[model samples]
Target chain A: MLSSTVTSLTVLLIVVFLFKEGVGVFDKTAMEEGFVIAINKNNPVDKLSSEQIKNIYDQKIISWEEVGGKKDSIFLFRVDDISNFYTDEQIGENFEMLPYRLSSLVDSFPGVIAFFPEKYLDKNFKGKKLEADKVTLAEFFGGEEWFPTAHPSAQLGVKPLILGTLWVSLGAILLALPLALAAAIYMSEIAKERVRRIMKPLIELLAGIPSVVYGFFGLVVIVPLIQSTFGVAVGETGLAGSIILGIMALPTIITISEDAMRNTPRAMKEASLALGASKWQTIYRVVIPHSISGISAGAILGIGRAIGETMAVLMVTGNAAVIPHGILEPMRTIPATIAAELGEAPNGGLHYKALFALGCVLFIITLFLNLTVEFISNRKKAHKH
Target chain B: MYQIDENKVTRKKKRNQKFVFFLFGAMGYFVVALLVLILTFIIYKGASAISWDFITKMPEEGMTKGGIFPAIIGTLCLVAGSMLFAFPIGVLAAIYMNEYVKDGFIKKFIKQMTNNLAGIPSIVFGLFGMSLFVNKLGFGDSILAGSLTLGLLALPVVIRTTEEALKAVDNTFRQASIGLGASKWQTTRRVVLPIAFPNIITGLILSVGRVSGETAPILFTVAAYFLPKLPTSIFDQAMALPYHLYVISTSGTNIEESRPIAYGTALVLVIIVLFTNLLANGLRKYFSKKVKMN
Candidate 1:
């Protein structure tokens, strides 16, 4: 009982922490929240939008001419650049001097922009402090682009990622469901016991293969095969991710549905056979309808595995954050995005929070699917009872 | 005429049955063929790169060459650390669910929660681990944080497997033990656990296989992109095998040169997982025979 309590508590804590970090991206004015961006006063650019700021930081808007300033290159600076900004002795002697030093440093570089904590901003400073527009919830949910670190503004639109994830998972299910259902039916009804004994272990072994190995295989084998087959410039497409995920999901689907089918009452099958029905007819008419709930549960579990899969999808999916038009196009999924980006996102930054929010989305989707499976299986049990 | 029509209908039914049977058989064969193909392809591609020195020495020259000793150590450490936490809690939970609690609301709820826990995506666990352990808990990117995350990841599997193992033990043995004036706890500890021990070990081996292959949960919680030295403590960062394969194959500077190494690393990982799985199957068979003898 205590162990179960701990497990539930850990899950609760994880949800809470993820939301706490994820929702921080909506802060309208970062300056009010202790962080601000300061730029040189002499620059002709009086104000900048969040989009413009992101572009500058990303070095996409390299020339001042791009941002309506004098013809000079933008120089980006951060307070953590200790070597270029301050010595250890100066920072140790007087903490207040740090802000003064920052104002002076901004003043010294005519084409420079610096970001630091709000407490470090000087009222009469030579540099000007730019107001950061708040990130709206609509922009986050409905935005078409996902260039989170774009100059002048961070684009947190997750539409492409959402669409991409759905595409790959849907494609995977489409590919896997038929094959898995056939295998399940065969294993439970058609195959001899000896064949099942040998085949069951092989299928279970498929589940045990590490996802990274699958990714490697996809990178070297599947990707090239698709490339040549389709004659696309690159083989790293959503098709490759779907194919690998379909293969990965097969074990789960086969195991569950086979169990469900095998559990059909022996008397029911006997009665169907005694009524002049063929063996295949008895399986189709009596067995399948009897275990439809279990079959759906298996499918849901397979879909859950496909949607949540990370490493293999990350390797073959091309990591392109675009709304994929077809299965052959490159795309990215939510889990792959989080796995690829979380390492570089600075802790507590908007980019980091955005990744957490992505995690939150993924969590909710899988949780919903899992609950559906549980509900279906529970209902099936209730019916039996 | 009626007899001839019935004969034609039977023939059509026979043809349909044959075709359906053939289709199902083909599907089954396809699945098996896929597994064989993957294994052979990996072995054939990776065989040339497997050398004793490549398995023993540290990586050098921007990881374009040298062995993967550090990654091997790191993977071993992670597996051990996760088992250290997951094994005990899982066993105790199973004991509570199977032995102590009656088949009632609480047991049902716990079982449901365990199912939900198992269904969560591993990358979500990665995010949770990153926030809770690495950032909020101040463990930073270290082995301890990674193991805790992975332990959480493996806990559901452990709990479910252990519960099954315990439930598989014949209830008459428990009744006999209790009828002999033994306390309930004593009967459980002395009678039930002994019978369940081999299956529990099987569960542990399976969880070990699971923990060793997982990549996403540890990606943020512990795995380093490149760390030359072996970790001396849980707090230190270390490179892990799965992550190493990911980096070299996907994002390495010299992808062409490192392809062989990626294949070799993948081969090693597959062998480890397959070995553990085989060991578990063997143990289950051995113990079941022992039970038959008893």
Candidate 2:
């Protein structure tokens, strides 16, 4: 009982700690560390969203009018650009008078927005500091950029990672379904008992093979084969990830559905056979329909595994944090990102918490999949009863 | 009229059946072929690297030339450390669930938690391990931290297997023991556990395979790319096969040069997995026969 309590409490503590570390990411401001965006005191802009600042910096927002300011072209000023405003001598040694010159230049331009470190600004500096927007849920989930260590701002958008996860898993399931289902169908309904006995343990062995080995195999064999066959510039593509995962998933999908198909009531198969149906027809018409829920549960479980698989994906999927356009393009997944970056991220830093937040995303997805599996299996049980 | 159809299965039906079976059979063969190709390819590439010295010597020259002795030792350390921590907790938890608790909310809750724990991704486990064991508890990326994290990851599997093993021990044996004036604990310790011991041992052996191959949880917790000396205490880090393979293949200083070493490491890890699986299966069959005879 003490052991059970320990086990339960461990799971509880993990969940709590994961969320507790991750929840702060949403509150973290999207701006760079110790950096402030300051405007002319006379400028009417009260606040600017992170997106608007990013756009302005990118020159997409060239006019101040775009952000509810004066109808003039915006002058983007950084602390280093003080030379354009004043000479080096005027700026002085150690830049003691640089803040004065910086504030003066900022005050002179109607559309000027100065970016500088917080320590440089005195309370009475004429320029008014504006609040950059905190990382919003929308941007965190839906925004495409994921440069968590970028300067001027750490882009925390996880859309590409999420989409990458989606694409690889979707492609994997698509690639795996036909082979897995057919294998399951054959083994459960058509194969001889002798064949079944040999194949079953072999398949289980396939499932038990370490994923890192598969990843290495993928890197060595599949990556090169895919490269030469497709004439791609690179070998480690989303296609490689999908192909490896499809193989990894085959055993899981086959085993579950085979069990389901075999569990088709003996009477149902006999009835189908008696009705002049062929064995193939009996399989599709009776066994498959009878165990549809269980089959779907297996598929959902496969997707969950594919999504969470890290090292293999990390090795074969190119680990590019970009939304892939096609299966051949390399992309990163949530797990790969977390594994590849967690080491360099300082403890309790913004990047650290963001990775935890990514873990949160991964957890939520897998949790949903697991619950769906639970629901489907429970429904299967209910129908049986 | 139906006699015409009954006299010969429809040509269309026959063709359909043949085509479908051919397709399924092909899929199965393809999977088998893929497995064979991977295994033989690794062996073919790595067999040259499998010298006795390679097994016994410390790695040298940026892990390109050395045998993986430290990694093997590290893997052994992690496997032993995790098994030590997880087995008792797992077996005891299984006992509490299968024997102590009846079918009710508490049992259901524990079962659900086990499933959830099993379903959590390995990388998330890595993250959690890094956060809790390495950082929060100040274990600081040592063998202790890595082993604890891996033990947690291995816990659900151990519990599931042990529970299944315990379940295989029939209720009649428990009743007979109880009828003979044995207490509940006595019935368990004296009668049920003995019967379940082999299967539990098999399960424990299998979990060893699972824990040893894990790369993610040890990535940050305990794995070191190249340590000057072997770890003498739980507080030190050392290389592991899976993580070592990962390093040489992906992040090594000389990946192209280390290809042979990478293959060797992968082969070694695969062999460990294969050995455990075979041994577990052998033990399972042997135990089942012994049980049947009794």
Candidate 3:
């Protein structure tokens, strides 16, 4: 008894810590994005409207000619080779892949002005000196583009990532539900016990395989399959992501639904058979209805899996930062975006907090779905009683 | 007796047999398809990469240029750590619920909650750990945090298994122990636990297998990356196999180059999972044989 109490108390303490950190991220995002300021001293175009700022951030206004600078050609200056921009490695080792170094490439090109993280910037750059002003930083924060390694303490937008996440997850869940249900029914009610005994473990084994393997499989197999079938130039889109996720969700649905169907008492099936129903008829009318609650629970859990999947969806989904208008359009999911950007996000910065907020949203979604399933199942049991 | 409809009955029975046979064949084919497609592909891709050097080297800056030593170590640490935390607590809870507690609202609730927990998608557990263990407990991205999260993840499974194992112990054994003037604790410790130990070990191995493969919970909690150095202490960071594979395949430096690394990692993980399942099956089979003999 004492041990059990201690166990529960330990669990409680752990939960409290997670929520506290999660909440800290939320608070930080609010303060950073809600109000801040910036000042660019080298160029007088800092006082621009939100729309103009959006265009500039989105790389639409690439040259000083477009935004009014020294000449038609923009002499862009970005951070030199530096480690703080991205790679968690020594400067010599990581300079090759570092975003600041990449930003230099962008700078050297004609009519290109790029930025990187503040820590990467030094006195070497000669173009824009973005002074630390709360108002200007706030203005940059309001834009809808996100390039995390942007120089200065400003100019990071998380809107595209946020939109990308919603687009892919919604698409995947829509695709997975019906197929999963059909497969579950076939496995639970139709398959023989011997077949099920073998099939169940194989499917569960599929679940145990790492997400990275699924990601590669999606990249190599599903992408090509979609391209050939649809005759699209690019196979990576919301639809491809949906299909991969559907495959992943299959075992969860089948296993849970099977358990539920197995729980339906023998008497119920016997009664249905005695009423002169065909085998299929008894399966559809008697067995399915009895296990509907379990089916729903399984479906929700499958959706949760689809929502939270990272690497597979990231690899195949094309990762375009746009709200998907159709199944064929490239999209991203919340988890994918979080994984892609979280490492680069400044620890206490607005972008980092926003990413955490996205996690918070995902948490709420899974939590609500789980609790609802439990509630419905409990009520269902009460009704039966 | 009268006019026997023997032909009609024979024809109907034949049709039923034909349908059942077709259904069974189709189900068998489907099962075989899954096993063949996945296993064949993995083995085909991964087998060639399994070599001595691949097992020993550390990962370089690029995933394509490295080995899976840290990941293998991290996976072992996670499994051992999770077992350390989960086994005792889960067993005790099961003992309390099954052996001591009488049927009531609390027992019923615990049963319901355990079932529900088993059904919860692993990502939620990730979220729970991200919030609860890593940040709240301030065990920031260390092996200990990962283990605690995974321990929570495996607790329900352990509890369920222990409870079932306890219940499966024959009542006569317990009654006989009492008949021999043993106390409740004494009987439980000596007879019930000894008989149930095999099943408990099976459950433990299976749970360890699961923790080793699980990426989502560890992603949120542990998160060691490209660390060439082994963890010298409990609080030190260490890379895990699943995350290594995830990095290699997703944000890979070069897909062509990383293929061998990915293959080797997958081979190692699959071998571990298969071994645990085989171990559990072997133990159960042995015990059942013993039971039959006695």
Candidate 4:
């Protein structure tokens, strides 16, 4: 037991190391490049409407003429040769196309309109003559445009990313908690032992499955269901992400709370029943209060799960950086944002640092939750004594 | 025993019988419904895609399609590499925790730390791997980096399980071994570890299953792009199955194109996990039988 505890502690220490390094890289990255907005030379605009921006991004308006540029067709450029817009040689010999290359390409192409990491926008790129100066990087991120690129300046003056993260996780927890609690109550207090054993493991197994599988499941089933049911053209929205997250969280919450409730002293349950209480009443008034700490802990753990979920939310949340207008609106979350961009962020830049900052926030939340569970469990033991 | 009372007793018996049956059916159905929903869905979607060629081949260009041969090999390397590093250290740590050091402050601190570690999010582990194992150590996009990271992730779980298994062994066995004039180490080696072997195996199997499917930590540490050939060395880059599935599923493409591949991957993953679970269960039972015979 002693040696095992040491080993586990060592692993935890490693986690501390990981977070420090990830954050360290991010900090260095941010300090090196503060902010800049690289705009398209051909489509240089003082400004663009949200719809126009959407259409351009979606490739619906493929010609520069539609956006008041040259009549030539807009060639959407990506950093890598994965797409045909730009050749590998054009990106430079040493430039490995990290994920952020797409944004950089959009900014550089004449008929293209895109964003890039602020640090990468050297004096040469930023100083390149534009037709207009009305649209600044600050206004793009700050004025409610949420294109989270690697460079800080490419944020487009928007805080939508942060809002989207919080809102989706909150919505998922709200939807999942009640259902999980009720199922746990039924499974633990009311079900027979044979039933409990089989049901419990099955639920636990659900938690063990990878979240990416959940993403696929959401893409094929939940997205289409939402689109048809809500009469929307697209179903990939905040609601879809939240619903998928909620389903994933259910098993964790149920199992933890059920185990806690089952461990509650049987003497308490019997006493309640002897005092002329019905089965439901005995469960509600006696068993539940006794295990309230565990239930709360389970809920917190579930919240942590919802917050940390990556692929599922990223796949279904429409990758929009805007704060959601409603549950049905497309949104983004902190974890999703990190997963979506971390691959492309230049090593040791500010854009990378901001991602680490988001990670730090997530870490704090999870740490607080785990500590609270330990604290409450200890308190319950103290009360028993 | 009167005739007038016999009807009431029969009615009560009938009601009790009906209630018990209802309880059993409700609980059974609740479990059955979920199993049917998830398992059937996986099989229905995945069965068509599974072929000998598909299993033996590697992924290629285009959004979807290809076999998972490289992924399977990578998953094995990760699991094997992690165990190679984790097992001895974990076992030694368990021994130290269980046999050495009387109750004290350091012991208590270690206990608290381990508990905290178990609950840390996996993504944090991934970040740590990126910094310490991948960047600082200069392992750089190698299977070794991923293995080390996963080994770290599995450490806490193995330690906790091994300790529990050790504690479960009866104290009397240790005392008897000592009574025979055997040394403490001798007694622990011959009497205690053997008794705990089954539990340790169970723990190890569970850990392997977890490392095999892990994605987030590997996302930063392991190779993401397709590798047509198998990794010949631990230092070589390899593509992991879970990470591959994640990339395919979230490539920002339509699901229709990606569904067949995702289903095949999910089916294979589920089978691996379930098989591991069964293996653990079998070992546990065999050990229990051995204990009974003794």
List residue ranges in candidate 4 displaced over 4 A: A1-162, B1-32, B60-65, B252-255
Q: Find the candidate with the highest TM-score and give its number.
A: 2
Per-residue CA lDDT of model 4 for B1-294, tens digit only, reads 546786676577567645644554464455346545766787789898888866788875553677888888899999899888877777787777787757898677777776666666677667667767888899988899999888877877787889899999999999999999999899889999999989999999988888788877788788666776899988888988788777777662654686687789878887787788778878888999998998
lDDT of 4 by residue, A1-385 (tens): 5446556556556656645644453223111143333356545454544335545556788886787766878664422343465566755565554324555554566665443344444444522322222334344334555554522223433357667766778888898787777778778776778867777767767766667777777887889899999998789999899888887888878888888899888888888878766566676788789889989888888887887778788889887776678888888877787777778876655455556655666677677877888898899889889
State the DockQ of every prediction: 0.65, 0.78, 0.24, 0.26
For candidate 1, the TM-score of chain A alone versus the native chain A is 0.77
Question: Which CAPRI level is candidate 1?
Answer: medium
Ranking by TM-score: 2, 1, 4, 3
Q: Report the number of the highest-DockQ candidate.
A: 2
lDDT of 3 by residue, A1-385 (tens): 6545545554455335435544554343222232222223344444344344445555566556565554554433345433334455534464544434543444444444444554444334433433333223343334465544442333434455556665666666666565556556566767677866776677777676666666766776789889999988889988888877877777777678778887888999999889766566677789889998998888877777777777678779988765457778788677776666665665556565555555655666665776787887888889888
In Å, residue B280's CA in model 2 sits off its true spot by 0.2
Regarding DockQ, does 3 or 4 come out ahead? 4
User: Could you arrange the candidates by lDDT from highest to lowest?
Assistant: 2, 1, 4, 3
Better of 1 and 2 by TM-score: 2
Writing each residue's lDDT as its tens digit, candidate 1 over A230-286 gives 999999999999999999999999999999999999999999999888888999999
Relative to the true structure, candidate 1 reaches a TM of: 0.87
Q: What ranges in model 3 sit over 4 Å off?
A: A2-15, A29-188, B1-32, B57-67, B101-141, B167-182, B220-223
lDDT of 2 by residue, A227-317 (tens): 9999999999999999999988988898999999898889989999998898889988999999888788888889999999999999999
Best by lDDT: 2
